[model samples]
Target: MRTWLRHHQYAFLVALRRLKVQPFSSLSNLLVIALTLAVPVLGASILLAAQPVVREIPTSPEMTVFMKQNSTLEQAQAFSQAVGKEFQAELANVRLVSKEQALKQLQSNPSWTDALGALPSNPLPHAIVLTLHETPDLVTRADSLAKTLQTRDGVDSVLLDSEWVQRLAAILSFIRIGLWILMAGVGVVVIATVFNTVRLQALNQREEIAVARLVGATEAFVRRPFLYMGALTGLLASALACGLALLALTPLNKALSSLAQSYGVQLTLSLPEFSLLLTAAILVAILGALAARWSVTRSTQY
Candidate 1:
């Protein structure tokens, strides 16, 4: 086992030396892989960055129902209950904001506190804020739910904040579709890159390959060095891609911090993202190697 390991290490060093001899050739291959990987990574990062904003929109885009001045507490509670039942699956939760709470909120404002305090009666009406669930069809559901709530007794009006929800849903949909398309396109590019690189390697080593076959070297033995070369090239490309991602993320992280602070959210890419990225890199290398091996094997046979 020890001797076998030493021979493998020697072979790897031989491959490395061979790769180093043709510096521009390896660099070109690496650049191609980096370019291919960058597209999907950029698209995915954008999608991930937009997630916090998209999620917050659903929670914030709530329907505010104002009660008629004449409506009693019992009437308001009953109406809230009906809404809760009707949208049990659609809504996250609902609560009736009392008149006093409304007054307190208004009073808390410095501009209106002094003048509002002078009024003999609290002019604020009871309101219900209906929080909706996170669903793709949230906007349509909100509209339907609003129409149902508008007809309830003692309900003055149902205001569905349609604009925000609609915009958010549209943004999320676009991100998802665009990311998938970008990923698919990147996959094709990587395959083409590996194919071209392998084709060149096979062409250049045709005489050597013929000599190896005459010496009784198995096809796998002839193919092994090229496979290793392809994998190494891909690995180098992935490293460059990771470096580029970090470079791109520096400004992105700063912007995300500012956005988080503004939106009162802790928006940061978690550890899982790093793991997935590493896995993606390794997968790119393995897939590229397999593609190169398959191409060479098909073109050079016993």
Candidate 2:
């Protein structure tokens, strides 16, 4: 174990020295890798930040049954009671808002004073609002209930208030799928970037590799330093990427914070998330190095 550790330590030392040899070139490679990685990392962070807000939104389906202008509060209440009795299993909460109550609510709101005051009589109809029990069949159930309501006595119209919420959910789902695709593409780009970096380094040192093989150095032994090189490159690039993301977020959040604050949420990356991103970066970088295996091997003496 001690011998193996020493070998690995030597290989890592060599890798670090190789990275330091041309500071400008290495820094440029790191920056390129960092920028490529930043795209998906920032996208993922934004998606995760939006999750809490999405969860806070009330997506439960609702139905509002408006009564005729001539319908009395007693009729609306009786219908509400009937709905509660008949669809108790499908219903979560049911409330009847009488026309007088709605008018009083509008009256309470000072903004409606002039428009409402001009009316000789209250124009609002009694409304029975149904909040359905959440189910996979919620839309189907709401449609069934709506059809039934439209046929009932004194019901002016049944309005279903579920489509927009469902549409919003669908939109978010599409965006999530799109984000995953973006991540996959970014991963490929990461591997390619690292692969090219390792390949170029290997080509530059091909003569040395050939001489090492002549000295009886096995491929694994020769490859260790390069592997460490790729992994370290990836690790450093990812760290830079995270820093870049945070820097980009500072200005972005300054703009989004006021808008997001209006909705009660924060849009910052968490500690665990940084750890996760770093792990991803290192793994991808290592893959890139391993992919450049042929480049580091000398098939014929150079």
Candidate 3:
């Protein structure tokens, strides 16, 4: 164990020295890798930040059944009660709002006060806000329930409040798929970048490798430095990418906060966990290094 540790320690130092020997080339490679890695990091951060917003959306009412202008508060309340009784298994809650209550709510809003005050009488209809139980059959049941409510005598219309939420969910699904494809492409690029770098280093030290082999050095010993070099390169690049992603998110968070504030939503953007990001970076680095080492071994053997 001690001998293995010493070997790795020596390889690690050699890798560091090799990078320092060509600072400009190392920096250029690091920057390219960082930029490539940053794209996914930025995407992941944005998705994490938006997770809270998505969670909040599902907690609200799924649909609203509006009553006709002539519908009385008693009729609206009866309808809400009937809905609660009929869809008890599928509905979480059903709340009836009278026209008078709707008018009061409209009056409470400063923006709507002027328009509402000009009206001779309250033109607002009664409504029933429905909170649906989350289930696999939620969409189908909700649609069926809405259609049933629409045919009722006092119901003017049944509006699905969760339609926009559904659309947003679909959009997020697409974004996730796109991000996965993008990450796969970026991973390929990273592996290729490391492979090329290791190949160049191998070619540069061809005579040295040959001399080591002639001296009875094992293939693992010969490949150790290049593997360490690839890992070190990936590690540094990933760290830089994380930093860049955080910096980019600062402005985005500010913009998102401003937008949320303007819309009167209590929203705050969150950063990705450091431990998670670091673990991912390490894994990616190790994978990239292994790929480079494999490519180098194949080429040298040929």
Candidate 4:
């Protein structure tokens, strides 16, 4: 076991020496791999940052029924329950936002606090918000519900402010799908880049591989160094890709923080993102190297 380990370690060392032989060429290839890997890393990070924000967005179309300023929480709750029951099938969720609850929620956001502070008392009225399911006739059903609620006793007005929300949600869904497709395509590019690099390197050593085979060296013996080189390249490129992706977070958060703060969210990427990208890079690099095994075998056989 010790002998086997020592020989493999020697092969890895040989692979390291091969890369050092042409430092410029090796670095250029490594940079190519790094750039290829960076695409997915950046895409995944963007998706990760956006996921929480997207989930927090209330996408279900909502019909807000504002009650008279004098309406009590008890009356609002009773009205909410009645409306919820009336459209149980069409409604995904229904909640009563009392004047106090609404004001308290608004105060939690810094952006609203300044404006709210100027008011002598909470200006928010008691309200029932009906969250409707996304269906073919969502606008129709919500519009009909809003019209019905507008005429209800004690209800001051009805606002159907969710059509745009649903449209935004649909657009986001399409963008998410497009991003996933883009990530997958870039991932393929990384693998292909690795495969071609290893293949070219193996071909460069064809004469050495053929000579070793003549000395009774097995295919495994000749292939080990190439495999090690591929793995090392993967590790290096992954590290570079991880670094670039992490570095991007600074500017990304800088822009995102300013925007996110307005929405009461602290958006930032951390070390976990580094670890995730590194792991992915290693796997992709290894896969690409392993994929070149047949090419190495073909070269050695000659």
lDDT of 4 by residue, 79-148 (tens): 8998888889988999887898889999999999899999998788998888888988877887888888
For this target, which candidate reaches the highest lDDT against the unseen true structure?
Answer: 3
lDDT of each: 0.78, 0.80, 0.84, 0.78
Clash totals for all candidate models: 0, 0, 0, 0
User: Could you tell which candidate, 1 or 2, scores higher by lDDT?
Assistant: 2
RMSD from true fold, candidate 4: 7.8
Task: List the candidate 1 regions with Cα displacement exceeding 4 Å.
Answer: 1-11, 49-62, 65-143, 149-158, 161-170, 256-272
Q: lDDT at 273 for candidate 4?
A: 52
- Using TM-score as the measure, what is the rank order of every candidate, best first? 2, 3, 1, 4
Checking candidate 2 for backbone clashes, the offending pairs are: none
The TM-score measured for candidate 1 stands at 0.67
Worst lDDT run of 10 residues, candidate 2, spans 293-302
Root-mean-square deviation per candidate: 6.1, 3.7, 3.7, 7.8
Error of 3 at 154 (Å): 7.8
Pairs in clash, predicted candidate 4: none
List TM-score per model, in order: 0.67, 0.79, 0.79, 0.66
Q: Can you tell me which runs of candidate 4 are displaced by over 4 Å?
A: 58-61, 64-172, 262-264, 270-275
Query: Which regions of candidate 2 fall more than 4 Å away from where they truly are?
Result: 56-62, 67-82, 118-123, 133-172, 264-275, 294-302
